[model samples]
Target: MKAYFYLLFLIFSLTSHGSYGQRPTYSEDEIIVKTVTDEMDQVFKSPDFLKKKNKQFQDITGTMVVDIGIIQSGKVATFYKVENTITNIDFINFVSEYILQHKFKFKLPKKMRHKIRYSITF
Candidate 1:
């Protein structure tokens, strides 16, 4: 009878301890955003996309801030220039139109199907 009771106690203890072990947690939106942002940074750094428009103007320096809205379909639904050099308005507008026409892919969780804001500066 003592052996049976000891065995029962051991089993109960093991079962309770198992529940206390590490449990898997769901991914958060912040993690998703960080991952997508990193991927986009890599894409921008690639030479395939950043082609030189003017070879003669080697010293041309300007920065443009693009605001993009990622739709649920993983495409750029809307794009606009939020900020940029005053002299580069035409360039910024052209890029914004081009981005809107092109399709983009982003890895996002199903739960976050809503639109997401992204900013690009170059």
Candidate 2:
């Protein structure tokens, strides 16, 4: 009897996960990227992106990966493990700080953990 119950639980678990994998409407990564882009625009659209550069200034370009944690309350509670960035530390900190301070327009699913990479050229 115990063995039968375990088998039943396994099948149910697999089927439920399979359902979540299908995203005929806006894959999770797509939603995450869109949300990040929109949030970043709210800040970087100012003089920040269009600031005049000095001769010594160089544009930094690379993809930055961030680990985000969303709580069941429909809000982001953590942003960490910034990676794949090959720019100055100041720039990385600036980007990371902006991400943490700004809220994504989309409310993530309950108890969701997401990671995404965004290209930066500035």
Candidate 3:
């Protein structure tokens, strides 16, 4: 009976993990990118001081989409996967921090934002 139980447990574990093999996992960067983008959208909609500041920096108006990997301790491990023409690193870094600090308010679209896994994108 013990041998049979062990075999059953092995089979169950294998089956459970087998289905997950086909799925893709998100890196840390992907999570950060999504977090930032969603936060920015939310901040833009709410009437607040940040919105005014965002507007004031109109020169940095171009969309900056970045893939960032943030650890649980809130440290950014990677910051190079940005997909934008803007060269203002300071602003991008500031936005990244802002996103991390605030709770995400915007509900991301299922199709477009669903790709984000463990990382965030802007």
Candidate 4:
């Protein structure tokens, strides 16, 4: 009887640990936001890109709003909107192109498309 009880307890403890083990701290949405921010940071910090951007707008300082759509396959399907506080046509075009060229590195469920509105500050 003692051996049988110990075996049962061991099985229960193992199963319980498996079911409630370590979990991710960040939510799915937060993870996606972090991914996007990290990618954008790389783009903003690139030497060649920064040189070009600086040449166009020496003192550019504002926020740019970007609306991105992600398909079920996790690909960036479209760039719906790109708006910035600085109303320079050249600046908008350059930034818009840079954003549109970026490839997001994440996946979503196959049920429906996901849309995210992200802001970039300069």
Per-residue lDDT tens digits for candidate 2, residues 55-116, read: 22357766666665544343456767556656577766766665566545455554555655
Specify the highest-TM-score model's number: 4
lDDT by residue (20-67, candidate 3, tens digit) is 534233335456466655655666556673565466555665556555
Better of 2 and 4 by lDDT: 4
Give per-model CA RMSD: 10.4, 13.6, 11.4, 7.8
In model 3, the worst 10-residue window by lDDT is 113-122
Supply candidate 3's per-residue lDDT for 70. Answer: 41
**What lDDT does model 3 reach?**
0.51
Query: How does each model score on lDDT?
Result: 0.57, 0.58, 0.51, 0.72
Among all candidates shown, the one with the greatest lDDT: 4
Off by over 4 Å in 1: 1-28, 52-59, 101-104, 107-121
lDDT of 2: 0.58
TM-score of 4: 0.60
The TM-score of candidate 3 is 0.38
What is the number of residue pairs that collide in model 1?
0
Q: Give lDDT tens digits, candidate 1, residues 61-101.
A: 56655656665445666776666664655555655665665
